[model samples]
Target: MDANHLINTLFPQGAEIDFDGEFFTGTGQVGDKIVAVLGTQGGVYIGVELAHRMAGIVLDTVRNHPGRPILLLVDTKGQRPSRRDELLGINGYMAHLAKCLDLARRQGHRTIGLVWSQAVSGGFLASSLLADECYALPDAEVRVMNLPAMSRVTKIPLERLEALSLDNPVFAPGVENYRRMGAIRDFWQGDLAACLATALDSPTGPDRRRAHGLEREGRLMAYKVAERVRHDPV
Candidate 1:
């Protein structure tokens, strides 16, 4: 009936489940439509696998429920940080998620994204990026790259990176920065109940990719990458 009860039913604490290796199912209704929330704050490998499972759920739901909308709650930190996951086709796992999202979209279901917390890199790409519409809590720490991790990977000193982030929001981490990047359309400024109400009330077919400036960002970057890919198809 309430959100807490709903969440508990979906994710009962002390329940033993292989979060990284299996599909967990919970059912609720979006108006007349039965909605399912798949996955957790688990790492990337599990997130990608969950995405595929979500897709399968969507297909089956559509067949049974006909035209109900699907809402996806995203709170991933990225793919699994494991050497084996990397070696054993991480790219393929991501592709599986992508294919599932495409299938959901083509079937005409209103696929929506709710980012409750950290949504970074490949995990974000696998789920939220494919949604028809997306929203995040105002306090949601959304980013393509976390600053510390980015600093380490980029080999930039943390202090200098922090200074650069003040001016370069792209490298900064926060909900507002994601808004600027066009990564998400709305922020949940109101309370959870109000926000969920708004989400249910809001029209789902809003032009997302273009409005978020992400399409432009990708188009501009596409040329540089395209040239290199054309030169070397590897």
Candidate 2:
């Protein structure tokens, strides 16, 4: 969906935002409350510039917004896979952005990530995956890497990975696969405004993706293994 249209649907009451075809920053109204909005669009690659800009927004929100909620609208292909970005330490910039969002959460600002479009690789990791609760639109595409790419990286045959993805949520891409893996809390359908509101009102908790993965049968042993590790005696 177009970013402007999505903003309107989410904040029917109106939002004070700025989008320059790639990055956006501003405040959005949600009933009696206001949320700090930061995001990317047009399937932009998350380069150092974009990562730094987003980190600044998060830090500013933490310092100025007090306890207001934050809404992250994600739509990125991934981090910029370029020699220029690599030379400039793009990973460090992405980490800074992630840290800023974590700071906001620790300071009592509710952080919610909504993947309105595509979210992949490091872009998703530094944004939506860092949120307290990450949700996605029904049509959103979320993935770390496609099967072919995974095959190249892991040296597994493309055919084998494709076959595994048929029954393994972790190896596939899509909102349903991610939901089954518990990376996505839920889908934002029906009423988007109400969905945002509910997310803001939702209580924050420790990461529950592993437990959700187990319950949904996407990853059967992750939760149990984590529990055993947590309780293991050194």
Candidate 3:
């Protein structure tokens, strides 16, 4: 989907915004406050430039908005897959963006991440994955990579990975699978504006994601392991 069309659907009263193929930052009258929505689209690869732009937006909002919630829309391929980016310390840039979002949450501004499109790899991690509340569109793709890539990475055959994904959703590649694994909060079955408003109005919850996954039987061991570590740290 074109980013402009997606933005229009999200912010019908949007009058000020900007998108330059890396990230989108703008003010839209979605709810009561002047909600600032920032996101990536068109398989954006998060490099140093893109990372700094996104981080700057979050930091600026936190400093200026005072009590407004910031909406995160992520649709990316991943961090730029280039030797130059790796050489320039892309990991540090990613961490910087994550820190800026974390600062927003700390400053009493509600943070909501909606995977309106694909939320892949480091692009998701450094942005929406850090949201106080995160969700996904029903048609959105939310995963690290597809089964074939997982197969290659793990040295397993694609057929074996495909078979495993059928039963073990942690290895699957859809919003449903990600929700079951406690990665995404829920599927946005409503219109984009309504969904954004609802999430913005909601309070941030404890990190019960692993618990949600365990109860749903999608992920069986993550919660227990984390609990044990909390009780007896190594």
Candidate 4:
């Protein structure tokens, strides 16, 4: 099915999915197996909500049934770039999401994030960052920033960025760069089921890239974040 069809199938318009305005949104079983759909348009509030709901689901599932894998599908431009979102304590909300993901890890729930389209900036951090494994579609236009936007924001000329993007996969926009960064595990090139199965089959542990040498690459901050998590379990 096409992307729109896929989204409609997953999150039907009439479905009574629970949502707390900007903080959380989802529809799934009460325990064990859970599937969440997060959009990119929402801001930090959405991230906060996503975390709150996931924690609730995890807690409920753990108290009742054996922990099951959580499937997450992400298609977002990024977190809300709004003054109100920042003023409403975005950092605290982000921290809450981090804590919820930590709970999932500590409890041994396989957290998998799938990027079907755009996964960027704070939106990526709020959800995708916490995954034990992450996968992106080959057609996904993923990136930290689009060239023109990056140029405008950084005050760098567009031609210079174009030059850099050609030589530096780090500056380009695509799924391949993230793979080189080790931030992504598998690229959904053909068979979606097989790719999902492989990601599900991955052994649980700290990402090696998160541990050593690769730190000096594009994901320097991610590396440092991983180290901090290692030093303190929480």
**Model 3's lDDT to the true fold?**
0.83
TM-score of 2: 0.95
Candidate 4 positional error at 15, Å? 14
- Write candidate 2's Cα lDDT for 41-108 as tens digits: 89999999999999998989888779989999979999999999999999999999999999998999
The TM-scores of all predictions, comma-separated, are 0.72, 0.95, 0.93, 0.71
User: Each candidate: what lDDT?
Assistant: 0.62, 0.91, 0.83, 0.62
Candidate 1, 176-208: lDDT as tens digits: 766666667777653554455456667766445
Q: Rank the candidates by TM-score, best first.
A: 2, 3, 1, 4
Instruction: Kindly report which residue pairs in candidate 2 clash with one another.
Output: none
| Candidate 3 segments whose C-alpha is farther than 4 A from its true place | 232-234
- After superposing candidate 4 on the true structure, give the runs of residues whose Cα lies further than 4 Å from its correct spot: 1-51, 58-64, 210-234
TM-score between model 1 and native: 0.72
Candidate 1 Cα lDDT to native:
0.62
TM-score for model 4?
0.71
lDDT of 3 by residue, 142-212 (tens): 78888888888989999988888787787778888888888788887757778777777776766778988
**Residue pairs that clash (backbone atoms under 3 angstroms), model 1:** 44-78, 44-79, 44-80, 45-80, 182-212
Global lDDT for candidate 2?
A: 0.91
Query: Residue 98 in model 1: shift from native, Å?
Result: 1.7
Cα misplacement distance, residue 29 of candidate 4 (Å):
12
> Model 1: how far is 115 from its true place, Å?
0.8
